[model samples]
Target: MHRLITVALAVALGLGAGSQAAVPFYDTYQLQCRANFGAAFNLPAGSFFTSSTPAINNAGQVAVNLVNVNVPGNPPGVWFGQGGTGQVKFVAADSNATIGSISLNHLGRAVFPQNFTSPNGVYFYDAPSDTSGLLTTQPIGASSFGTPIVNDLGQVGYRVSFLGSNAWVSFAGAPPVAFHAVEAALDAASPYSFLFTPSFNNSRQIAGKVRLGAAGQTGENRPDQIRIINPDGTFTIIAHDRDSDPNSLFLSFDNSVALTDNGWVAFNANLFPAGRGVFFSNGVETRTIAVNTAGIVSTIESFGPAASASGLVAFRAFENNTALRAIWIGDGTTLRRVVREHDIVPTDLGPARIDQHDASPVFGGSITINRYGDVAFNAALTPPDNNQIEWGSGIFVALARTPGDVDCDGDVDFDDIDAFVAALSGPAAYAAQYPDCRWLNADCDGDGDVDFDDIDPFVALIGS
Candidate 1:
C-alpha cells in the first residue's frame, strides 16, 4: 500500500501550534460561581458585600465594586478579579466616602471616584503597583468619570456629566493630558439627556447612545440615537433615526450596545414592536441578525466569540419566549441557531417583560464565544428575585463546540485532530490511526502524514 504523506508538515504544524481561529472573543476564563448574599462578589461568608459590575476585560479580569454594607451604608471601593489566577483583589479603597462604581481596563487599571471636595474627580488604581493615580480632584469642574470603558492603549472613555451637559472624555497615555469632552450637538430638547454611552474599540472609535430628552414621566427614556466619536473629537451618528419611531428605538443603555474594531456595533433596535432584535455589524445601515425569531423579541444577554484580530465577532444570541428558549450563533450578518432546547430562567434583573418592574427571561447571565467558534454562556439556575425571594441562583457557565469541531465534542482535542488528519490522509495511508480525521489543515508535520506532532498538542490542550 502506498502511504500518502503531507509535505512541509512541520511548518504547517508550527503555524497551527500558536494559531487561534478568528473569533470575536476568546474563552480564556470560565467558572460557575455563586455569590452568597444579594451582593455581587462572594467575599468569605460574613463581612463585605462585593458585587462586581458585569464588565470584563480582554484579559479575563473583572471589575468588582466593594460595598461594605456591614458598615451600615453603601461604602464602595474598587477591586479586580484576575480570572486567570482566580484572584479577586482590591484595587482602590475609598476613605472619604467619595468613590462610586468601579471600572477596569485590560491592563488591570481601575477608575474610581476620589473625594477631595474642591474638584471631585476620578482616580485610577494601578493594581500591579498598588498605587493610585488621580485624574482630577477639584470640584469646580465637578465632573464625573462614570461608566468608564478602557482599552489596552491606555485610552479611557468616561461620561463627564457636569454643568447640565453630558459628554464623553477620552483620556490617553499615562498622566493623561487634560482632555476635553466630545460634545455632541443636539437639536435642543434637553441638554441633560445627552448621556454618552461609549463602547471603545482598539481603533479608538467610541460608539454610544445619546438621549434626546430627559426621563419621561412614564419612567421611559424619551428618545435616543447611536453616535460614534473618533479620537480627534470628530463624530457621526451611525443610527440616529429621528423620523423612524415615535417612542425612540433603543430601550436600555447598559449592555445594550457594543462595538468592534471593524467599525461594527452590536446593538438592539426595534422595527416598531416587531420587538427588539439584537443586531450585529450594524453600521450606517441597519442590519438584522439571523438568531431565532423568538429571541429577536427577547432580551439577549451577551455577544461573542469576540472581535478577532481580524475582526470577527462570535456570540450566542439567547432568546426566551413564554414557551420556548433558544441559543444561536450570531456572526455580523447571519445568525445560525445552535440549540433550541435550552431551558431559560429569569436573571437577577426576572422574565423578559416590556414595561413595569419585571425581569427579562434571559438565556444566560453572560455569554462569550472564542475565535475557534467555541461558544460560552452563563445560565441562571434560579429565576430572578423579581418575586422578591431571598433565594439566590447559581450561575453556571457553559461552552458549545464550533464548526471545525470534527469530533462533535464541546472542545477541540485529539479526536478532532485525528478526524482532521483522516480527511487529509488518503485511502492508502495509515487509516487506523485517524479514521475520523476531517480537518485537512490540521495535518501539520506533512511528510505526507499525520503523527505525534499533531496528536500530542491537540490532546494536551482539551481544557484550554
Candidate 2:
C-alpha cells in the first residue's frame, strides 16, 4: 500500500517538473493517506490512527493524535505527531494510563495529559529540543485543561474544567477566568448557550460561534452566529439570517469565522435569511459579499489566519450528499473555487457513499488560508485496497496553495519576494545558504522566472 502511494507521488513530482514553483500542500504519516511524501509512513499493527482534528502553527508545524503500538502485554498511551518530520512521540512513560486532549502552538510546542485529567502531569513538548515539561512548573494554577490554541507569541488559550466546574481559558501566568457563555435570551431555563475558541490572530482577537437557545424559541434561535472578542473584554456579534422566512421553522446561521492580523473578520452567512450562499466581512463596512453557496457549515473543524488585508474568507463548501466538495475563497465581491478531487472511477475505485449533513466523504479537519488566498485543509483520498472501500479509506490529502505564491515563502507571494530580495541584497551568501529563498519564492508577475520581475516590490522597499 505504501509503495503504491509513493509511486503515485513520484509520478506527480515528475509531471510537475515544468512548474518548479508548485509545492505539495500536505505531509502525511505512513501510507494511511496521500500526502506530499508519497505515503512512506504507516502505523505498526498494534498502533492505531487518530482523528485528523490537527492543530497547525504559523511555522507549518502540525500536531495530530495517535495511539501506541500494542505489544503482547503493554498498555496504550496517548501520542502526538509532529509536522516538520511526521515524528510521533508518546507524552511519556506512565503517561498513557488514559487519553485526553492535545494542543500545539505555532512554535510546535505541545501540551497533553500524562494521564487523563491528571492536573499535575500535563506536559508541554518543546518542538526544537523534543523535551517535555510538567505543567505544574508553569505559573498557571489549574489542575486540568483541554482544547488549547496557541498563537505565534506562545499565548495559549485552553478550556480548563477545574475544581468540578465549567470550562474557561487560562493564560500562561494569570489566574484563569471562566469563559462566559453567550446569553441571547437573558431569561430561560438553562438558556443553553456556549462558545469555544475556533481561531485566533496575533492581535489576541478570537473568532468563534455563540449558540443561542434551542431550535424552537421566542423571536428565533441563532445557532452558530460568528462573534469576535478582543483581549480588552469587548465583543461584537455577526449573524446572518439564512431562512429569511420571517416565520421560518429553522434558523441556520454561519458556523465558520476567521480573522486577519489587520483587524478584518470574515464569515459565511445566509445573505438574507433565505439561506442562499452569501459572505460577509467586517472591515470598514458591514455589508454582504458575493457568494454562490448557502453557507459554510457552522462546524469549521479547522481554520487558519485570513490571507488578505481586503478580507477574503476561504473554506470548503458543499450542497449535500451526492455532490462535489470544493475549496472556496471569497474576497467579498469575487468568489473562487480553488481545489477539488477527481471522481472515483467505478471500475477501479467502486461505489462511493456520502453522509447526509456534510455530504463530503471525509471528515472536515482544520483549514488555514495564508495572506495570498492559498487554502490549506486536511482532506481525504482512498488508498489502493482491493475490495474494502469505506473502512480502509484514508483521509489526509493536502493540496497546493492556489494562485501560486501570493505571500511567497519559498512556496509562493509578496512575503516570499520581500524575504528573497532582503536575503539576496543583504549578503552574497544569502541565496546560497537559503536556496529556498531564491528557488521557492513566488513569481507573481509570471515572467517565466522568479528574478528581478519578482523583486520589483523589494526595489520599491529599498527606495522607500
Please tell me which predicted candidate would have the highest TM-score against the true structure: 2
lDDT of 1 by residue, 1-464 (tens): 11222223332344344323311222122432334455533343222322233444444455444443333343445444543223234423344455554555667676765443334566676767866666653323635546565566766666665554556666665444332233443223333345555666667667776655543212234455666667665666666533324564544433346666567776655444445555554445555554334534254434322333323344444445443344555454434544332243333333311111224443333333323443333333333323334333322222332433444333343345445545444443534653432243344343334444654444334323
Candidate 1 TM-score to native: 0.59
Candidate 2, 282-399: lDDT as tens digits: 5336544433434432222233323345455656555243245655555554455455444331111233221112234453454454333334344444433322333332223233
TM-score for each predicted model, relative to the true structure: 0.59, 0.61
Clashes of each: 44, 24
Q: Which ten residues in a row have the lowest lDDT in candidate 1?
A: 20-29
The regions of model 1 sitting more than 4 angstroms off are: 1-29, 38-42, 46-52, 69-74, 83-88, 91-103, 112-120, 130-140, 174-193, 211-224, 242-256, 282-287, 290-329, 333-464
Candidate 2, backbone clash total: 24
Scanning candidate 2 in windows of ten residues, the lowest lDDT window is: 27-36
Local distance difference test, candidate 1: 0.45
Q: How does model 2 score by TM-score?
A: 0.61
